[model samples]
Target: MYNIQGYFEVESVNEATALLAAAPHLLVIAGGTDVLIKMHHGQIEKAELLSIRKIKSLQGVVKLEDGTILIGSLTTFTQIANDPVIKENIPVLAEAALTMGGPQIRNVATIGGNICNGATSADSASTLFALDARLKLQSNQGERVVPIQEFYLGPGKVDLKPGELLTQIIISPENYRGYGGHYIKFSMRKAMDIATLGVAVICKVKQGNILEDVRIGLGVAGPTPLRCPEAEAFARGKTISPETIAEIGKLAVKATQARTSWRASKEYREHLVEELTQRALKAAIVKAGGEAIA
Candidate 1:
């Protein structure tokens, strides 16, 4: 286990920010599921620890009057998966949250930790990307909102500034209303395994069974969770059919830049990207109250 030079439990966001500003070397911990694991593995060196778990403001789900859903940064996965507002609005996000580890891990794993981890295989990232979520970053100076899609700089890197804490995740009402979404995770095992490939799709249907709008988010197939814009554009306004879906799958493979890893070969991962994309799209369409043509 790594040595802890200092440990402070802050009860408010301002207190957390103050501590972070004063001690820039201090590591932030929300649920401590991820950070504690790293510390135990010796992946993290000795440093001060600032625990934000006691910050009351950073928990639960709020539906703002402006039609935006504000999720506290410290909200646990279990909370997200079971929150009525989240279940009714962004069902795909709830579905994704449930797949992230088992019940016990979900009870303690915070959404902020998952996003801040910046792993390509993060289950929530792709769905959050598809939902067009935004993050509220708070510092002693003030707060600023950044689109979740632009939050990742690279693997294990994020856009968070020094002393800035991720305070909330904002999901605009427009994304979830009248839209159907699906999140699919391909892994070797059914539970407690990182995704080999993750696919998220959100679709809106127009008259004539055409896809009015579609968004695709992919995980574990690139340096960061990716939005397959080309496939989305191609699928938009197109009649839902096997042929159209197949073509979109092909586009997904072309859009992804995957590398061979111990879990999967490049070619195999590419195939999964194609297959999962098609399956997710079809499921999303069906969810949108459209009939999928096999």
Candidate 2:
């Protein structure tokens, strides 16, 4: 049972924002994925609870007039994984969603909760980062959209202001138009294990030989989900040869500052970053119907 405190079940976005503004120590709960666990362990203290799970506004995926995809904040991982539009366009995200915990967890865990938790090993994070997703945050004052890459301040920390609630995630159409990508989560076990390292690669292929554009998103290899700009730049306009792929892998490792953790050693994490980066890139190439130069 949660500690005795005030509770608010907000049914609309405005009500949620108003509740947040009034309760300085209020904690928002959607799907209760991360928040309940913390509360159970007594990790959360002296705070009123605000439940946004019933808010209908934050519950589905929609395509905008301009072809951008808008995913409501409360959409569950299961909803994301099985959504036809998501699978058809940005399947890398769906694949990532499938690898998060088990069916039960995915069924209740909202994508908003996952992103808001801001874990370094957040499953959906790397894929969304590679897709160059943006988040819409709102408060009583107003709303603003922020690039996902800038939303993280550090491990277990985010840029969300006290009364601000993340409302939606937006993905530009250009990212999913002519691109293929994959998310590879390396964990001790296939299910219910946090990623030791995760790599997401989205690439636009040209003529089955060259890469037109590339984005590499890394997880559990740094303080936040990281986009490898240097490696992306290096891969662009380069023939996807064995040597080029190898060099890009090295660059990805160089871009990360992986540390020794209970799950793996620093050296081992670096090795995974190098090997997985190459594998993800190669897989993306194949998915894009391009052949890596041998």
Candidate 3:
């Protein structure tokens, strides 16, 4: 049972923003996957919820005239996994979406909620980091765009200001174009489990199997989802060989600040970061039309 104080259903961004401005204590709820569970556990008591589920503008996937992809905040994991535009332009995100929980959960878990919850283990975080995604935040005052990397303040925390809501997730063409990407979630179980470690790799392959560029993102490895810049810098302009991948894997470990938890030991998570980085990078290389390294 929830200790409810109030519940407000909003129909548009403007309405939601106005409500938020008036009731700063109101917690924004979309899918309620994380919020309801917390409320049920007494983590949140006497909570006032402002539901954004009825806001149509905050739903669906759209490709803009500039070729950028705009994913509305309320877009579900199931919708992301099956969307033709997402699959064609950013299949890595789709793959991550499919690995989240089970079918029923995916159908109701909005990407907005997942991101707003600010969990490092969230399946989509690493992929979004790798893609250099940006967030569009709106308020009754106005709107602003923030780079995804800057959005996370700490574990279970984000940079949402009072009266502001995440409206859309934006991925520019320069980030996804010509890049083949892959996401690997390391968990104890194949389903209904959070990632102990998640790895996402995106790379562009040049002639003769050289890596034109590469980006690696890791989740549950630090206070927030992080990119392995050292490894990415090392891989850029390097030939995609077994030796190169091995070195890159080791370098990727430097980016992690993993800590022991009930789900995994710090050492074990580090091992996954290294090993899975190699595997994910290899798969991404292949997807980018590079030869597979044995």
After superposition, the stretches of candidate 2 with alpha carbons farther than 4 Å from their true spots are: 292-294
lDDT of each: 0.91, 0.92, 0.95
CA RMSD of all predictions: 1.0, 1.2, 0.7
Q: State candidate 2's TM-score.
A: 0.97
Query: Per-prediction TM-score, please?
Result: 0.98, 0.97, 0.99
Q: Which residue pairs does candidate 3 place in steric collision?
A: none
State the displacement of the C-alpha of residue 53, model 1, in Å, after optimal TM-score superposition.
Answer: 0.3
Worst 10 residues of 1 by lDDT: 205-214
For model 1, how does the per-residue alpha-carbon lDDT over 1-294 read when each residue is reduced to its tens digit? 768988889899989888888887789998888888898989898868999998889999999887799999999999999999999888999999999999999999999999999899999999999999999999988999999989999988999999999999999989888899999999999999999999999998877488888889999999899899899889888988899999999898877889999999999999999999999989999888788768
Error of 2 at 284 (Å): 0.5
Q: Model 3 segments beyond 4 Å from truth?
A: none
| Full ranking by lDDT | 3, 2, 1
Best by lDDT: 3
Residue 159, candidate 2: alpha-carbon lDDT: 92
Q: Per-residue lDDT of 209-274 in model 3, one digit per residue for the tens?
A: 999999999999998999999999999999879999999999999999999999989999889999
